[model samples]
Target: MRQTSIKRLYLMEVGSMPEYQIPVVCYLVQTRDGKNILIDTGLPETIPQEEADFENGQDVIQQLSRIGLTPDNIDTVISTHYDIDHAGRHGAFTRAKYVVQQVHHEDALSGNPRYAALRAEWDQPMERIQLVQGDMELFPGLQLLETSGHVPGHQSVLLELPETGKVLLTVDAVPFAEGFTRDAPLNDHNPDPEQARKSTLKLLDLVEHGQVNLVIFGHERAQWDGLKKLPEFYG
Candidate 1:
């Protein structure tokens, strides 16, 4: 049998904060076995600029159109967490089963105010979600790294591409490469700083051990600017 590989990996940029100097990004992975997996959902189109620093054209649906895809085409929607910008369009993909950490799903449904704004978008019917716990392989080369520090039950992803090698996406666990190198400094941003630090260290160890060839930060502007965006691909 032929081995499965990531055929194409599109780094989708749905929105950005010019003033804050960061870009809100998501990813689309097309596998050799015919799978369309989306990482984050970005912001919803209906969200106003005054409410959030995002442009209307930067919607995920619009971005998908650029690559001849729609929400219905997506096979799976992996929600790293239910932050407004990351899960704002979850309700749109009716055909795709949403994947999330079991703990995050429970906490999100508990009416946490931080994720309250986009509750309607991500609080899907229980049947629509595939809740997984701890570390697990989503597929042959794709692994979900449970890094619950940035938020409760937050997770990251590791993709082992045939040509591109191992790519670790630290999501918000380490929002910047500098933060990862500096050992994930404790901050008011993290609800659980110690947990966050442990998660960060775990990722750093992977990098130090030469297991990861690329590290993508959640909202790192400098790194996002240098990445291969939609229409272009890593694999």
Candidate 2:
């Protein structure tokens, strides 16, 4: 008889919006081999009040310790795209290799204030960086799905869990379940509205056809409230 290893998944609550108090989260995937894979690093400990009202709740690295791990435990860091909020805390996982879209990496360093302002987090010197050009499988059963619309290099993640089935972390691709239901555009200060809309529909189609078992949106307050947060493993 042979035995198989089981993987676990958790959602780390990084912070929340000041106004109305919304959640900012990131995914933590613990592989069967004890390897840690981080989806996105949430907000920094503090953000500029002038840009947006927010509170950096818990430290992700600290949070990891609570689960018997540390920043050094992270083996890979995948950024769906480099927006201020999504790329804010990548600096913490210094021991992990960064996997990002080549285009997004370039844009973040291209001096656009939106991303440039958060340069310290993403631009710092690092090695073992993997800049992906398109969708890829980071590992078996864990795949990156490109849904670029809200930004040029946007992507989503899909993980096949033995107990939980198919789980899709939509990040900013869908924004919320509401967008998927109505085929509505994200009122997310998108740079390209047309592209955002088109990409959103593609995601909706995946859900409609039953390709995804569960979908987790980026920063939807209502949806975030109902999810199983960190310290709670999905699979």
Candidate 3:
């Protein structure tokens, strides 16, 4: 068996929503093999505060530079989903191969005006995009969870670190830790509430059976406030 080796996991708060009190987060996962995997890209730099609040040195590129990296240094860019808050800076990393779910990508490109805003960011050259059908291991220690409901093909992450153990990132699948339970009510963001609930239940089961050590929600204000941000990593 291949030994899972992850060096660091950096949580980056690239932007925030004051009205809802949610933090827009992105993760930078560094592997022992020197791979930089960036999961989700926060809002674009040109975004107005009316949509999402952002400050200087908070964009994807700026955040990378803080850790002695650039877009070129990123080996893979994973799209949890193509929401405006999650994929605005995706186009910037032209050198990185993009990973996303097939269903989600099709839905985003299905002539829906809701996703039209950031189509340019995600609709890159086909050669650069790797469409995944279902759950699979992206790397030795990194696993992708297909937890749709928040969107057509929204997915989450299950990452294993040598010291930190298993870390589950339920990105938008269950946006808040308070709502992570089986009986938690679904929010309006879920277009398909039933499917969303099933996804959440699946994740809950994984936590119980898979021995998950840390769980990070999508836009949870309280959780984000307590987590270690970039430069300070969890490994």
User: All candidates' lDDT scores?
Assistant: 0.86, 0.78, 0.88
Worst 10 residues of 2 by lDDT: 1-10
The TM-score-based order of candidates, best leading, equals 3, 1, 2
Q: How well does each candidate superpose onto the true structure, as a TM-score?
A: 0.94, 0.91, 0.95
lDDT of 2 at 57: 77
* lDDT of candidate 2 over 53-108, digit per residue (tens): 76787867777887888888899998887776787889888888998888777877
The candidate that wins on lDDT is: 3
User: Distance (Å) between predicted and true CA of 163, model 3?
Assistant: 0.6
Each prediction's total of clashing residue pairs, residues at least 3 apart in sequence or on different chains, is 0, 0, 0
Q: On TM-score, who's better, 2 or 3?
A: 3
Q: Which clashing pairs does model 1 show?
A: none
lDDT, candidate 3, 1-235, per-residue tens: 2378677899998877766677888999999989999999888767745554544237778988998999999999999998888998999998999999999999988887766778889999999999998899999889999998888889999998878889999999988888889889867667899999999999999999988999999988888889999889998
The reply for model 1, stretches above 4 Å from the true place, is: 1-4, 48-57, 182-184
